[model samples]
Target: MSRISNGQLVIAFLACRLSSEMITIPGEMVSYGFDRFAVILFAKLIAALLYLPVIFITLKFKGDSVITAAFRRNRAFGITAGIIMSVLLSATAVQTVLSVQRYVTDTLLNNIVTISGIAVITASAVYGAVKGLSAVTRSSVFAAAVFGLLIFLIGVTMWDKVEPDYLYFSFINDRSHFLKTLISEISMNSEILIFAVITDELRSKPYKTVIYYLPILLILMEFLNMLYNLILGPYMTKVEYPLYIIASLSDIVLFQRLDGIDAIVWLMCGIIKAALLIYCIGRIYTVCSNKPHTTLAVAVSGFLIFMLCVILGSDAGVYERMTKIMNSGIHILLGGVVVPLVVLIAGRTKQRGRVKKNDENI
Candidate 1:
């Protein structure tokens, strides 16, 4: 398989990293009160700014995966970072399985095929991971296009339901709660940095050029959040999946219900997301073992994911608890603190090595 271009990298990052989860943002935002939209947006904007330095550092080690960069730069730090990331990614994959399963059962299959949902999702994810990044990239590119069309169609269909006035005037009533929720959103979205390790596979572009992609993604997410909040109103806070509710309300001449379409699109997006996480785990495992068989690494990682899905399938609550912990706890530690520290330490180490090399040459 050919290496992915920078364009593909962006698509993969956007599609695999971002999803209908943005639909839940409005629901989460409403909990802080409809007044919090501005606060959440501002908070997300700040978080995006903070991500800049990490992105720059990631690009500096573009050719190497994060695991490789860490180990080559600092063995101890790299191993520690790997363990932290592995736990988070594994937990995320399991959660993705549960989310997709529950969504499918509730929205599409009417709970009849609920138990089989996780199995189906796990199989699809494992297939993509085993096929390698090239396959994953191709799938993500296609999925991104389809996802865009779906979002556009939904926006048009729901145009009348949107209360621009409410969204425009909304403000967060509780400053502390708004700040806490904003931090959570940042932690969740910032996992895209995991892809930075493979940035070398992308086409080389100006540093600032990559930064431009951030706003586009953020805008799309913000729009989705706003739409959900407007349609569901305060009731959004009670809805587990606001996007599903929004999709259900969609009606056209031929289709009375669009929830199925949204569910399918989200299911595909979840597959891509899970595959990427599995790929990261595989790469980390390979790097740690110093193994040359990327194929074997992918298989082993895929097996683990499949096993986890099966184990978590019987108790949906367990999956939710695991995700709550990872999303709230591990994501904060890894994305908010551990990763930035690693980048700083790696940057300093690289500089020192360069100076030493220059002195030796002199």
Candidate 2:
């Protein structure tokens, strides 16, 4: 894969985050007032802080990833880094597949988004991974545009149904609930791990991407959270997909309803996210073997994700438990903080040795 523009990265990551948000599985708060509003806000702030090491190490190498840089310094170090990141990315892909499956099975109102959604999506993700990030990035632009339009239409239509009384804060009195939700939000920011791996390899460093992606995501989350609270009020907790429920009411003159549009856009985003994870995994394979058979990586990733979803069936509780175990705060800390710091130290140590050798020879 070739290097891509920062703008592409921004849209791709944004799409992935949007997709993750659209498919909130079990274990996430059902309703419980506006605590999620604060959760989204503070969780992202903390995720950004946690992800600083990764951002720093990636940019530090100029054109190479920290893993690649470290591998050049020591083969073992590089392979270890590759293995660690591969696990994290694989877990993320599996989690995404499970979430999509869960959302479909739980919300059976729409035949457009079918029970076979995971298989179709996995196939598309493999194809996209083979096509590479550039292709996925282009698709995300369209998905984002569709999603933005849907949000606009929903907001306009549901303005009358807004109830400000449901917008009360509750995280203050609920410390344990607040922390659990915060960790989940941070864990859901898998795009951070995606960004760290993909950008620096063959592309420009992601200085502008991070700046644009996070605030946009935070603002969008806040808007959607507020919209959920306003339109559904206390009743949102009863259903699985709040966006789908709200989209059912998006009845304007030109169109009938937008629930189908909503489902398609998020399904598109989920594919984009999965393809990205597969693509990044392939990139890591290149780093490990110095061979670039990304197609093999993509194929293996798609197959595994499909099988996992199939084996797990459509059990929301089981998928949620597995994902929670796989993508906890500890995993985030290891991927975003601990692993990057190790790669950085390896790269810097190698650089210092090179300098020392040059000086001694001189």
Candidate 3:
């Protein structure tokens, strides 16, 4: 496998973090009566704070992949983390696939035309994973370029229409709701797990990557939220894809409409995110089994996730239950908090043992 640059890795990371949520986040924020602009910016601040521990852990490992480093410290702990992360990422993949299907079917095509949207996305993700991280990383760069262009066009075309006064901040009276959204959104922004998973394949420095990439991601997220608030205001809650709706109103000279461009960006980013999730699962499978199972893992994982979407079968209750579980920071607690803490403890224990041995020898 070829080593990928930090820029490409960050692009892939941002693609996974930014795409699907672009549509739902605005609505989610509006429904909870949180200021759309402030909440997104707030979420990034919270995410950066929460991610400090992970950053410290990554620095400790230096050139090692976090997963491999954990295994060297304690195999059992590493395996546990892998299992937890695999499950968490798989659950996320299912939601992503569903979101992509919903958006494409709703905006670009009819039900009959997009009946196989789920299958196509799953297949594409599997193929990307099978091709390996290098391919996916390069593809993310292309996706990011497209995303950048789309963002530029939106900002330029919509500038005259933006309402600066609408960019308001307010403390929601519903404390519980506000806290939940805050925690969930922060956890949602923890796309660092992907970096940890593929640490070995990346050519960039971890500390620098985190420092440079996160602020940009946060700023882009803030801009999008501000755009939504400026154009749609409180009415954004009524729309399914407010950002896409805003894009549709763009009046660039060459492209009179930008919704299709917006959809393509979302679709491509969604697929990249799904592929990265599958790739992460495949990495864990390789670690646990002590063999490369990339092919088998991607196929089986994609199929299982697709089956899950099918089994749930448009049931609102089931979807809500799944969403609640995924969004409740359980993944963050288990994969981000618990597993890393355990690994850190194990590393300390092993280091102490080595130091004791040296003292006794002396």
Candidate 4:
């Protein structure tokens, strides 16, 4: 099968990571501080630093996928890592489904509308995954182009309304709160895991992936934060969907509002994100079990994830899961730290054995 190019993966990855932030994160930023822009910038800096292990993992397993490398080096360790990854990817997929459903129902459309929307979204994702990573990557590139154009239009339309004075910095008064929020923001980034798994799929060097990704992600985030604070000012934190509200306020000549277009873009991006997770799980399963169940695995996983969305989309359940995921260090610990460490150790051990055998032959 053809592999996804680095450009395609990066575009898809960015769409997945940034789509949720367009609406949800801007509001949460307000609760942290009046200088939420500065706080977010700082938090992003922290996240960049924290992404080092992922970079290392990527570099270490550049020519092969993490799962392939693990299995080649050590089967026991491969099984352990595979199990950990399956659980983590499943959780991530479920959350993505639930969150997307919630966003559609609460912000974009009615409950009735959400049913059709859910069906279309889930079906599209499964189809994309079944088509393979290359197909998803191409679709993501197209989605990214459209999404970028829409974002550019919004920026141009809203440029005049932005106030430079709103970009003020203030000391973080609550140290504990700052720390907690910083950690939460960092942990919210599961895109790194996608990078780890897709190392072999990438045609480019692994280190280049992080180099290309983080700066763009950080800059986009900073731009959105600034835009939110500049236009919304004191009212930024008061709204539930600040980005949507911002888009609604944009009045172009022929187009009275861009909110509808923005809604579609968000949904498309969300599906790409969810489907990418499903694909990752399928890839890991296929490699670990030494079976070619890619299409079936993705279909079954997508179905289960959609069911999870229905079950977990309730207020209390979503709040519980979201809180646990955002606040917990499990993602960072397992995906970021432990998985990479295992790969590194296994790789080194295999290399050393080769060296010893060569020396004995000499």
lDDT of 3 by residue, 1-362 (tens): 56788877778878887764653655564553335455667877766665555666676777666577787777787787788778777877887888787778888876633338888988999999899888997888888888889889988998898877765667677767667767667667546667667776768766666777778887877777667778887777788788789899999999998998888888988899889888888988887677865698778988898888776636768877776676776776666666666676777788899999999999
Q: Between candidates 1 and 4, which one is better according to lDDT?
A: 4
Stronger candidate by lDDT (3 vs 4):
3
lDDT per prediction? 0.67, 0.78, 0.76, 0.73
Q: What are the per-residue Cα lDDT tens digits for candidate 2 across 225-340?
A: 88888888878776668899899877887778888788888788988999999888888888889897568877987788788777765675776678667546666777778888
- Could you give me the TM-score of model 4 versus the true structure? 0.90
Estimate, for each residue in 1-362, the C-alpha lDDT of model 1 and write its tens digit: 24666666667667754553733445554564455556546755765565555555555765455566777777777777677777767777777667677667766787556447766887788788888778987998888877776777787898888775555554556777676676656555634545544444455642433565566667766676677667876677778778778888888766677776777777788888888878778767766666753867777777777787778777768766765565454564565356756766777778899999999999
In angstroms, the error of model 4 at 87 is 1.1
In candidate 4, residue 292 scores what lDDT? 79
Candidate 1 similarity to native, TM-score: 0.84
Q: Candidate 3 — which residues are off by over 4 angstroms?
A: 23-25, 31-34, 113-115, 168-174
Over 4 Å off in model 2, which ranges? 25-27, 30-32, 108-116, 169-171, 201-203, 314-317, 355-362
Which residue pairs come into collision in candidate 2?
3-202
Q: What TM-score does each of the candidates earn?
A: 0.84, 0.91, 0.91, 0.90
Ranking of predictions according to lDDT: 2, 3, 4, 1
